[model samples]
Target: MSLGDERESSGGYGGTGQTRTRLPDTDPDSYGTQRRGPRSSSRGLVTVVGVVVLLIAAIAFANRGDGDPADDPTTNKPEAAATAPTGKQPVDAKAAGIPTGYAHDRQGAQSAATNYGIALGSADMYDLEKRHAIVNTVYAPDVATAQLPDFDQAYSGESFLEKLGLDKNGAAPSGQTFVSRVIPVGTKVTSYSDSDATVALWYTSLFGLSGESSRNPVTESWYTTTYRLKWVGGDWKVVDFTQKEGPVPVGRDQRASTAEDMTKAVEEYGGFTYAR
Candidate 1:
């Protein structure tokens, strides 16, 4: 879903569909930071794959401080995770099949925030009733009640869905494919404590419709979703979260794909449960 122009002007769903209008050039806000430009140059997806590598390095530097790896202007040194295996493994099973029960450590907190980013940024957030289940599943039980009403407005807000070419229920019309997905690229620990931690999950999101005749055709947008996480009942849960624009690279102009082809690609490519 490439909503570059439209989203920039209208302020598309920034981090779970709040009433977002625009992003500052590069300062922190209530949600996210600045706005992301379109990925029109060359093959955007391929470029996205490459950007993830740099983001991994950026996360390492942020955690370890503006240290050795990034200090030298010429040294193309690798970050800790890129240099060697961290020995951590993905959780095999899920709580309600959602990859829960994270370790009570720094790495574990990072892992939990990454996975929850995927869950919250998912298409499930669009489905009115289904959205509730996702909130209850990943968000702490205490704040979830207060959060639901705001979510209801964002996801089911009357003309908002219409603008994206979705039906009242957030579905694409028959024969059209609606895509709302988040692909996590990196993670960083902003702050951490035994019971509380702040982490940011960097990722790309796909939103809009995939159909030959669609108006709001599928678009790609970059985002960094920051989460205020809490260790609860032996797992990390989102106490609060925010979304901001990007550090997107300049895109190289390229031929656009056909609607049918875009739809096919989206269908064939499955989403993965991201881990740190």
Candidate 2:
């Protein structure tokens, strides 16, 4: 889904005038083991594109919330009470999993959006198997069934996977780790209703092709991606989403971290259950 085709610039990190690697040659057996129908794969590709766009929206929203002239009103408020309620918490999580299982209330919708935002931007999504699981888990049930096959096709494409420095099923080389991680900074409910809600998910993403022969090495970018969700099938499922440039702060000249440090930080830093 994230083609990494072109380099664009704005906010904290400037584009380095480089694009990620290209996909590799196709093997006929690549899709032989796939369990999806052609129509299903088409729907899955749409879901992947939608998720990618939503991720960009979350980054822009986070960077915007970080202190921008245009975002003064939203920023001026005292930050939401950091502590969540003690009982019947609207939030929910599976043991040791990314906090995605949310309730159906306004807070629940916001929480779902935020959590799904993390899952969408995670490094795991780059892998073929993991990407399939993520799409099935994060999207509404019906949407997942209709979309998973296509997502599988898109990511499994020889050229596309090659671009990300991955093999079929999106796996990186033995000694190399493919990095596509999202770090959620916070979340805010821009608007809400009983059945529909718009939530702003703020976070940063780590995306690039990383390996010895990699064209695009690991690099980090800040952004905020927002989603419009609908309470469907007893959970909050994304109905639609959009993205914009950013509320990114001026660039800082902090010394860049080493590739190893960046990789370690990604592995060590876990995402959060964001709330307004």
Pick the TM-score winner: 1
For 170-216, candidate 2 gives per-residue lDDT tens digits of: 77777656777666676778898878888887665566544444444
RMSD of each: 14.0, 18.5
lDDT (tens digit, per residue) of candidate 1 on 169-246: 988888888877777788989999999999988777766667766665666677777788898887888887766777
Q: What's the lDDT for residue 48 in model 1?
A: 28
The weakest ten consecutive residues by lDDT in model 1 span 24-33
lDDT of each: 0.67, 0.57
Q: Weakest 10 consecutive residues, lDDT, candidate 2? A: 7-16
List residue ranges in candidate 2 displaced over 4 A: 1-3, 6-90, 209-214
How does model 2 fare in lDDT? 0.57
